[model samples]
Target: MLPTTRSLRLGFYTLAIILGAVLAAGLAMRHAERQALVEDAARANQQLALYANSLHTLIDRYRALPAVLALDPQLRAALNGTVSTEQQDALNRKLEKINGAARSSTLELLDRTGLAVAASNWRLPSSYVGHNYGFRPYFSQTRTQGTGRFYAVGVTSGIPGYFLSSAVTSDSGEFLGAMVVKLEFPELEREWQGSDTLLVSDARGVIFIANQPGWRYRLLQPLSDSDHADLKATRQYDKQPLTPLEYQSLRRFDDNSELARVVGPDGTADYLWESLPLTAEGWTLHLLRQPQVAFEDTRNAALAAAGLWLALVFLLLFLNQRWRLAKMRQRSREELEQLVQERTRDLRTAQDGLVQSAKLAALGQMSAALAHEINQPLTAQRMQLATLRLLLDHGRVDDAYKALKPVDDMLTRMAALTGHLKTFARKSPSGLRERLDLAAVVDQSLQLLDARLRDEQVSTVLHLTRPAWVRGDAIRLEQVLINLLRNALDAMQDKPCKRLQIRLEADEQLWRLTVTDNGGGIAAEHLPNVFDPFFTTKPVGDGLGLGLAVSFAIVHESGGRLSADNHASGAVFTVTLPIDLEAPVSC
Candidate 1:
């Protein structure tokens, strides 16, 4: 059926709105996906750097070992002449002791012709004493270039190791033999076992070292005829079979990273691949992390964008309807009066919505600030858990039980904090009013941070009157003291001398408490805004600057005054509250 012009126009508008909302949702989802990938790349790059450092440090530790042994006079004299069987035994003992002292995998001395004369593993059936390594690349390279390095499987021991070799020359500059130190990475590989896959591949894309068993000796690319022949001649990987790893790049983030789909031993899966080139070793460290963008995050972004699109469309429709109604105002006085009444109701509804939205926004901000305050305790809890795990692993049940005590305390503190924060957010009276001991509050606050004080070696002095009375919430007061103490500790970082002093005394009807730190006092300009929300002198990502602001609010609600000042040594923060005459001297 043929539609009227008005009906057709309305149908077309509805179609456009639907399409626009879908378009907005798609765009938002794509943006979220890209953001997630970018974050993955950043984290993968950091992990890549750490893996590279570990590899480089392990290699460098043994780089000079072979060279040092080459300079040994006793080792050189033994290799110069045809030694008796007794002298050969002595050389083996000497090499074994040196290997034990250096904690190296094995040490072997070769003659000018590359025949093993003395070896640390002389007692083993697979001893390298009679092996001729003259065919090996390291031997040839050392004979010609004075030093050499190679990673290869030991033909005798059937174990893979990195070999560092240095030429042993006579006093007259004649090359005699090579001194070699072998390094194995069983410990390093064990250390890397976790969620992510770590791989170290050579220049030819042949992976030799991997944290996962199935990934070792995997081929990233097809080896050329020359490379294949070289591998066979050098016996670099010995009997280890090289399996090809099929991977396709789904997206490229940069030269060093990409999103890749891999058909590995674990079957098909997508991963964010990050590579770090080790120029010194001519190897590349690869970290494969699975894409971890939560579905909820993408869904939320799409929903928000679509909602915005619908809102804009409705707003235009509303304006159009208003304009049409305005034209009718000239025609009917009665209709205009009805329109005025309807507009008033609409305005009232909008005003109420605006107020509710403002409240929600304020609540969200306050919640974020509370989260900032609790972050330290949460972080400490995580660290304590890690320590507990280690202690338990070492059979230190007593130490592990002791460690659990602080975790329990932190949990109790967090539970109380969450309840108080909800109350603090609702615009309730500053804080609870009750008779409490200020000294007790201070002691509890310091107890929470006792580990930090001992670890940072900060000297703390307490000068307080016992059972100093105060009228405030004990937990809230503890929060304020903790914030000040943390700020002081942060300021004192890297300083030559770190000292903190806390003083509590009676002043008229008010109890006065001051916190002093030799942390190079706060800047004059920043002191004015210390209690202001979101004002931070710290570098971005280091702090949220909500601690002091939240602390100030908590204090103010408790009918207390909190102020900051600068002193010769550092910063001084004072809290003044009305004394509660009811708090007991003990218990």
Candidate 2:
């Protein structure tokens, strides 16, 4: 039963081909992973650049404020002599006005001895007035370097802010004092929307700013005794506990970036840690991201390499066995092209159907708002008619006539509301944008819900800027506004104290509208999915949970953004739309 020479040769060839394919696949997978890492590093570097720019822009904005204030004649004159109580009051008022205008955190005028003579926050409990910052390094650096910058936690205010200082001198060139401006970074942290961990570590390797919670004040490296002494002297991160971030470098891509296994507050996890030196502030911006690879790419790479190897091995066999193999290959290619074309057409049709169906579903889901808008005007007309009857019965013909006019107005409003609702029920063209007043949309939504608000006894606060024009479908925008208003009302329905605030203002070149409610806020876990279709926290029978989803789509369709967040009291939904330049400016 021993195999012949030819059979044995074929068996050996088969084993060698299998081994070669396996090696090729393995090598391809490794290459895929390395390529993925390279891409991730590129993205991380770009993100690092953006973050560094943000930090630099923030510092540069306030860096000149202290310098400009130092040149003030009043500040120079005050620093030259002892500041009396009245002069201190005048300086405080001036600083307050300037701080408000500049939108800086807090400004303080310090004497030559570094005692705060006047501060913008003089009225607050943690005011900086009378607090001497003589021990801080920024004060000394200003005296020596003429200008200085330091980031620290304010000992008096218990708030963390970047301190920018400039020297004040007299006509004789004598060092008079330092003008200091404090800049807090809470807003900046909130604005960093990256999913990766962003940490800003100072020269001492202590992280002072982080986008992620519980990451701040952690040390990138162990602080030396001198560093600890300096921290204590400056009270840089006062009252904040500093902890070591236990980590091990797994791989180094370059000098500034690496892959690491870190035991952080969240948990033990691996991250691609990238660092950028912020030379201006003596801080290092670090971005920690988990390495991510697409399974599809790896699998395709392995398949492609193995297929190429196998095809070469089988090429001569196919040519020797079947001279018609080339014809079959050409036929297969044609079939594949036809199949792809068919699939593309089918997919396009399906997508079109889905979009149309979603639009219909969106309108159908707004039955409650439609009912309210129509019924509100009807109810108002009924009450006005009753008043008219009473006045006519009491021989007050003028009052009866006046009341009838309101009833007529209500009927006209009701007709318009129903007309718009009917029009919105039909599918409109894709490019149905119209230049309309965003403020008017807000007013219309509020009018529709006014009766509901009164019924629920919810106090309202409105801060609207008039003539806020934007390009969008008026009815669709109204629908979005009404959905936000309705959600706010539902949130506060069971609250003991119900308060709803609606604000519409200009932000940059966009019209920003916010709807806020006091209803104990949304649960943290549910916040992310609030606008997801069919995502609802209400009782099963109460809703199908499509309002916010529809509103989100409508806003996006109008080239706008819709977002939701939890505030101290409850949830706030913001709708941001680009301002329409073709429309008249706000009055």
Candidate 3:
């Protein structure tokens, strides 16, 4: 018996459904996790905003100190160049006292003539003291805005620091000079240190300082080596465990806070980090929380849940397969019992019905072929009858004899056609292989569609190069071609520019055949699924959707491949068959 297409299709769809269900379940779980993560991120962003405001205020206070020093009367008189050496020393000593309290890196005062008149900790050369400080942005801002604050490197200190300066004026309210102070970061690192949090203050683009211990801050970026070394040394003072061997994850967010997650070597405790931004540069104030206290139970639960889900899936599959097999066996027994009780006539009737169903499926094309096939014989019979009648009317016996020969030939041709139809309609026993010319099979297929093609004003271009042979059933190949041509015709039914082209070519290895139509092209998304059974773009009731799929199966069974692609103008389907050179061409 030929394999039932319906059963095979049912099995395939069942497998697909099972796989799709498993994939959908996994995707749903992943989506839930993603939604939870998004919620956490929103909360983190809210906390970051509060931190930014606090840091901006602290920087403002540092700028206020420089403005107070520039307004001192003692400093103004000395800057005016009217003071004694003892008076100048006293002014310098007073300025040094102010700088020491701030723990600043450098301090200086400059007069209206751009002359530095006072210094702290570091001294300037006598000739260089009166040179221009007006050219620097810090001093220029102090002159323009009367008070300015920014981070800049020292001209003399040669170290990166914050420069806070402001304009100075006399009691008459006339501008006299400016006072500037530089606060070096190494000093700040000592005072602003935290226990658990690694802190870094990046001024403008440079990281002037960092406070952390050892290799804990080794892999971080946007910080210099000196800053990292300082941070590592500070962390060591706290007696915290900081090791490079740990698999640590440090995340630096846009808010400048760093989250450090460290997985220790022994796996005894993982780290969970929370950071609060600094009140000074919006930099981080981190707190590393030991995760063993919080997430150990959650991790164990997750592992257990994952294990249970996998076990459940396998159990379900096993139970489902067992149930399906039992059901299949039950159905098979019922079918076998029915088969035993079925009469011979019933079986024969069923066989005939199946054959008739196949014929009706191709009825439209078959009707066109039958009309063309019978028309020639009927025409010959009519002409002979007319001649016989005329010969009898004229009483010409010899003429009637010649007409009898033609009449016999027409009847014989009609008999041969009926015989061919019987063979075409019969199903060959399974596993029977025959060597046949694929080109002749194609010709027979075209003959079935010839009348319809002509009626639709569709023309076919045939390029039968040579005898391309294949080891396959001719009837099966013919059926595939008939389906293809009919589909082509239906596709072009509404096209104003309808054309069909079939080209056959062969080499030593393969037989290549292409059927092309100048109709509306298949949509791009539909191309891949065009061969799938029951997938049709056609309107309802227009197609059963099994033709191309059946055609695909037929080609595959013959050790061939069939593919459809969208052409620029329409759709083209090509078939490649492995050819047998020794096979004889069959009519």
Candidate 4:
């Protein structure tokens, strides 16, 4: 069989469930990934901003120290070659005192010849006393450009720091020398020691400051021959090798944020990289933040969400399936009920047809009996009229009066017979029940078939001794009798002895009418089909084969049993009706 609607619906719902689960999973994964990315970017940006602000504030705080120190009369007089050796020594002590309060690594005054005129670290072992610092970019650039800044390893102290310088001058703007201050970031590196990776790179992409010592002075990019030569001449990093850090830019979000894969001692790891420009120092600050924890949390949340979504989808599908099943069941029940009603109507129509067929069969037989029955009474009345006329002609008025009474009696009998025939032929009411006389129904039926029975030489014997009453439609009961009598007549037509016997008997609970024909018994095989419609042993034109079948149906509808059996000499049909004790008995 083809699949039912319910099955198809289930199949469709199953597909939808699978698709919905897949869709939910995909959405959850995407949402988690997007959320992780956004959070990482925001965090990286915030850290970058903080680092940049700290670096800027540190630089700005010390930026004015070099310019202000350049204006010192002692430092200026010593750098102008106007101060004596004792005065230069005094200026050195003074500069050392100032450097201690300024938190600067070194403070020195150099002459226009790039020779140290005075220094703050003159008393130290690694000092700048009498050192020729003209090879330094800061000193040379400051003499030419009036001010300069650079990151380099100090030639005298052998320590790395950012150099800031300002040229010294008289009121006439003559270049005397330069005052320089060295800013070391050891404290800054200590402050940055934590989980986050912080780096400051110079313009050439050389990492100048880093929290991790291993990353300091490393090249963020590859060093070409030109950059190598420049670094060599400047001695910016001293003897430090500028190795390129293993950093690969995987994806860039914008100018400030990017995803980078960095090869480290542990393994390759991804980091969200954010950068900010240090405009005053011509450098950049970078912050590398690991997002593993955030991503792990997001993954767990996404899985949970996907699980919840799948469960909800299943619940909805289950409820929908239940509702659809209920509707289908209701629709099927209604369809079954309608089909049953149609079948009931068909059965009622067939019952009505059977009753109508029995009536028509009775009418056919009555046609012949009606002529014979009317002719007899009519003939007797005509004879009586002729006799009355004769008596009147003989002047016997008393005798004529007696003849008139006999004629009137004949007319009354004729009228009564015609009335009964008319009643038998009329249409029967549907589902009507009333008190009825069984004997009268049998007499009326026999009266209609009387002429036909005589023509067939069939003798009918009635065993109705008294009136038997039943509750039924009178016309239908009469039709049942007529059909039985006609069948008896047809059965005995070819037999030498044609006899039909009818008996009406009753008990306390039941009344029965039996019609027996004295003809050859029906064939054993054909007996069972005797009451079936269109089943006949007579000639085709002689009978329509509906007589017994219709009679059986009529009796059955009137709450009676109709049965047929073979007797020793012929066929017997019996009808048994339930007795109605409340019915009045008639004589």
Candidate 5:
């Protein structure tokens, strides 16, 4: 036979639910990927800012060296007076000593005619002592403007460095020569070797410094005719080609970030390009980072979360379906049983008679305990009434009145015991909820059991620290406490050292009452069945085994829990009741 229409509909609904979950999960993954990209871009921008600051600090450190050297008396004197062989040698020694201490690439004293008179590298094979720098812009610019800066490849050493120049002047304010300091940043470039690509470009869109050597001296944009002419005239790059880097802006995220396809020396790939402007020096720093790893992690995390959510949804659906099927089977079984009962009405009547007989037998078993409980008060009342009658016969009215008081108290005690038995046998009340003091309820329960506790020689301890207000029926709560106390007392009846402890604690959310007894603890095998209906460890006729079950139901209905555990010395029962936060505080 084919599946039913209901099964087909259920299958379709399950498929739809799965498809919808997959779609939502895919959207979430995409959103996570985009957010990761944005965060990566922000981190790249911060790195660019740090690199820019480091470069600026590196350059400023050499800026003051040239001006300070311009004020040296030996260099000024060598330029102003007639230069003999001895004087030139002395000037070279002075410049070499100063350059060595400053850790600069080179320091030179240039005459007004732009010819190097003394150089820091005079000891090297390729010395600049007699090299003419008349073609260099730093020489002429400093002569006219008092100071100048330039970045270019060295004509003598063929090394790239920045040149800082300051004009030397005589006491009469006559321009004599210029002091030039060459600052090379090989260490700075070495420090930038890492995963990220770092580059700095001048205002003219020409890259001067880069971690990758192939990227250095590349032009970000095509140069104008005039700019090319100026570079040729100054010989700044010294015959090096100013190649244009192949890059296309694929997408722009914001003003500070973009995605670009860059053709590097190795190959072409996409990169996240982040830029920060160096406002102090009119330069810009760029950082290129790969986004593949970050995007992959985001995708994985989203899929994991989606998978977990889907699993929970499927589990819940399966449980609900199983419960529905079970209910259907139960209903069918009940109908069958009802039909059978109707056919065997006379047989059922006989069975009912047998059930009543069994109930009567159970009542007979309980009769002994009940009789014991009621006998003490009844016997006391009888004796007191007899004494009262005797005192009245002797015409002692005052003594008779005292005797009558004792008889009345005993009768009242008996009435209370019977009332408790009636309440325990009846159905639990439905709508008698009120805000009641939990401490007072506990005290009342303890008072009802006080005589039994004293008779059994059980030491009682109370740790009620403060008022615990809870919402529930007072009678029901008291009944629960009374049952627990009676059970604890009964459990310790034969123990050598009998002790019962009750504690009340409350927090903002709930009130907790703990009842502990020293009864050598409950047996591990019987613990799980302790709260089950009609299941107990006591002898058959000793208990009906419904006390804890009834207490558990009452506590659960009142939005609380009743739990039992074995302590080292005995058994512990805890009752947790929800505190009525909105109720007025009471003492």
Candidate 6:
């Protein structure tokens, strides 16, 4: 039944008072939180920025000493021309004196290619003496990107330290060499740890440096169930970098009280962020605090005073109409039930969509691998048929027979390829586990691409750790090996030195195989993105870019992983496979 106007008015007032108190308290807490957060972020950032400036100034001072030596008349004269034994001895003595006076660690004189012509304090290996330093980012960008700098690990001070390098050039704009100065990051770590705050910098938002020394700092939280889900949501939003104030708010905001002022994206909100720029490190620091913490006492007092007023008002309302209040409570309970059902349905639909998307992605990767696998046999068949037709047209009966032999071989390969596809498509039960010979599986996979390897003039050296056993799908393990070899061949195709090495190592419960090539190595920047799906370096139409993605899936399915990195000469892809724990193993 519909309520009367008087009852409706009373219910509206009750709801208004409850909601108004909650909103007022929340606003009061959040306001104070924002102010405190701003102060804390500013103070912490100011100190870090000051230290960074101090470090930069010190580096600049030490770097200027080399320019002083370069301007000295005696130093320039000794470097310009050849001299007799006595003159050379005197020049050497002068250089020694300058080096001793400068007191700079690891002084070196380099030519145009960054090769060290002479050095002080430590003798550098001749192998690297004339090598090109142009590949290093600091040297490469020095002329154009003036005052370029970067961090690199070095072993000059009887211990490893970060080397800061700067370019050295003559007055006429001729590039001479680069000067490297070492700074002890460990010492800096100690200073930071001793301070009340921490400093972190994300290198142009790509590489994140956490100030702690010795411990490998992780910018991302552990993807564990125990971590607060709200925090992860904030982290995902942060990956694309937020405004300076937004970043500070996310870090400094107290999570316990659900009170925060989030700056709206696109600068949409007026009372949103508190922008605090840390000028020293050129970082825009954002600050957010817990609003509840700020106004808790005041809010509590206000509520207590309001409670006395509410008591008198409630007494009058209840005395006038008790039955109407019970009816309103019953209606609220019914509305809550309806809302729960609707939200539950929505959540279920979202989860189903996520599962479907994951399946589609997996299928897309498999399709690409199938394309690569099928193309090999098809190409070989075409070449073989072409050769046989030429022999037949030439009336060379013996040669025709010889040519037809390869054609026959191609058809057999096609049959085998079809067989592999059939096996992969089968709906076999995977829960049943059994011990399988991993090396045998790898050898069988290599046979699939033996013809292609021979055609491309590529050589293989297989060092098998025999009797290796793993608990996994036999077919899937072989597929992983096949994908790796195919990728290795693709990587080495342009190299003058065409060689691939496949080495295997096995323990009682694990198997590791390394597929290496002697081709040009991978560029450092592109190394991390290689495994991402649809990421290919090949020209358009050459690849759909799912080779490694499919390989990774197979390894993971078998309780293993595949990793790739650049070696000294070329790239190396290593696969680690889980094996039977009780298997008898030998190398």
lDDT by residue (tens digit), candidate 1, 391-500: 45335788688767676664455345434321322222223587778998888788779999999999999999887877777766786898999999999997988999
Give the per-residue lDDT digits (tens) of candidate 3, residues 427-468.
Answer: 443234688878888877876677887788886778886677
Report every candidate's CA lDDT.
0.80, 0.80, 0.59, 0.74, 0.76, 0.52
Which pairs, if any, clash in model 3?
55-279, 212-231, 213-232, 213-235, 214-232
Alpha carbon lDDT at 438, candidate 3: 81
lDDT tens digits, residues 1-587, model 2?
35688798889989998999899889988997887777677667755666676776677556656865786788899987888999999999989977876688999988889899999999899989999999999999999988878888889988898999989999888999999999999989987746688899998888899999888989878888888888888888888899988999988999998889999888999998999887657789899989876675576667667766666556544443334444544555666677876665555655565565555445444543454564466546545654464345335787667666576664465346534432333233334798898998888778778799899999999999989989988867887998889988898888988999999999999999999999888999998989875578988657656678778878998999999999998999999999988946598
Cα distance off (Å), candidate 2, residue 505: 44
Alpha carbon lDDT at 300, candidate 2: 62
lDDT of 4 by residue, 431-546 (tens): 56888878888877777777887777776687994678788889878867877776777668788878788888886688978899987778889978887645688764565455
1 against 5, candidate with superior lDDT: 1
Global local distance difference test of model 4: 0.74
Model 3 bad stretches (over 4 Å): 1-61, 81-83, 101-106, 122-132, 171-173, 190-206, 212-587
TM-score of 4: 0.53
Evaluate model 6: give its lDDT.
0.52
Whichever of 1 and 3 has more lDDT, that candidate is: 1
Error of 4 at 135 (Å): 2.4
Considering lDDT, which of the candidate structures 5 and 6 is the better prediction for this target? 5
Q: What C-alpha lDDT does candidate 1 achieve relative to the native structure?
A: 0.80
Output the lDDT of residue 383, model 1: 53
lDDT of 6 by residue, 470-515 (tens): 7777766666788778878887888766999998897556688899
